[model samples]
Target: MTSNDIRFDCQHRGDGGPLVIVPRIDGTPLTELVDGFEIAAGMQPAGDAYGGLIPEFFRFGPMQDHFLGRSTNTMGPKTPVLGCECGEWGCWPLMARITATADFVTWDAFEQPHRKARDYVAFGPFQFDRHQYDDALQALSAEIGSNVDDTRA
Candidate 1:
């Protein structure tokens, strides 16, 4: 595929649960998502557990999205630090690029002078904008429709 061509795959649970999107891409491995429903502890019986949105991890690595798995509530403040309770790969400097590209995410910065090394600066956990997410999914769906037509031609 060319640089403009992007392909996506969707996987569904046999039990009729949330669907997962697999974006096959080659890059810096910047972001990954984890919906609130995926968490076993805080899962609600009804509605989208993550407010119909998927939270993204700014950093990249194996299972980085699951770094907050131990926490019952993954919606809390996210500290972009390496080897924290949340996850292993922590990159505070990526905030600029993340916000610039992701219009749906809003950054909330704070201070923590007590911590060692990465003191005095930390941003809140990234949250997904419901409207933007839905819109994005719709766009992807439309792309899939067009792809089907292209193949028939």
Candidate 2:
């Protein structure tokens, strides 16, 4: 689908701590989508083997930088778009090549680092409107930040 079909949001794991910010696309959790793709391909989904990145990575600056192709941490040309359910990025990752232009941000070349043989070529090359993409990121960051603040209060 084109950028218009893409959206970004967050899902909080209850009692999973204020720092936990699990990203959701449309209304489904990201891990579920990955699992669905795997299942559709006749391969078992990672299930609990997948999860969100650590809290630090969700912050506006780092996250924005990563998506915008300005971050240094990368696996070759692909970036770790999702991480292990254990909260560590390197353990298990869903990598993608993210590209941003003046008006659109595109994500393609998805790979499951540990399952090199599993093909994700048909999964996604989701293109997102730059404005919507940025707004979603900012909103997620703000929501996360506010949650953290509420927790401390």
Number of the top-ranking candidate, with TM-score as the measure: 2
The alpha-carbon root-mean-square deviation between model 2 and the true structure, to one decimal in Å, is 2.8
What lDDT does each candidate get? 0.29, 0.72
Give Cα distance to truth, residue 34, candidate 1, Å. Answer: 12
The segments of candidate 2 whose C-alpha lies over 4 angstroms from its true place after superposition are 4-7, 11-18, 57-61, 151-153
Instruction: Quote model 2's TM-score.
Output: 0.81
Counting clashing residue pairs in each candidate, in order, gives: 1, 1
Pairs in clash, predicted candidate 2: 3-127
Report the backbone clash tally of model 1. Answer: 1
Cα lDDT tens digits for candidate 2, 34-148: 8888877887655666887665644434566776666566658887777888777788888888899989888889988788999999987777788888888787667767776
Predicted candidate 1: what Cα RMSD to the true structure? 15.1
Which consecutive 10 residues in model 2 have the weakest lDDT in total? 1-10
> For each candidate, what TM-score against the reference?
0.23, 0.81
For candidate 1, list the clashing residue pairs, or say none.
78-125
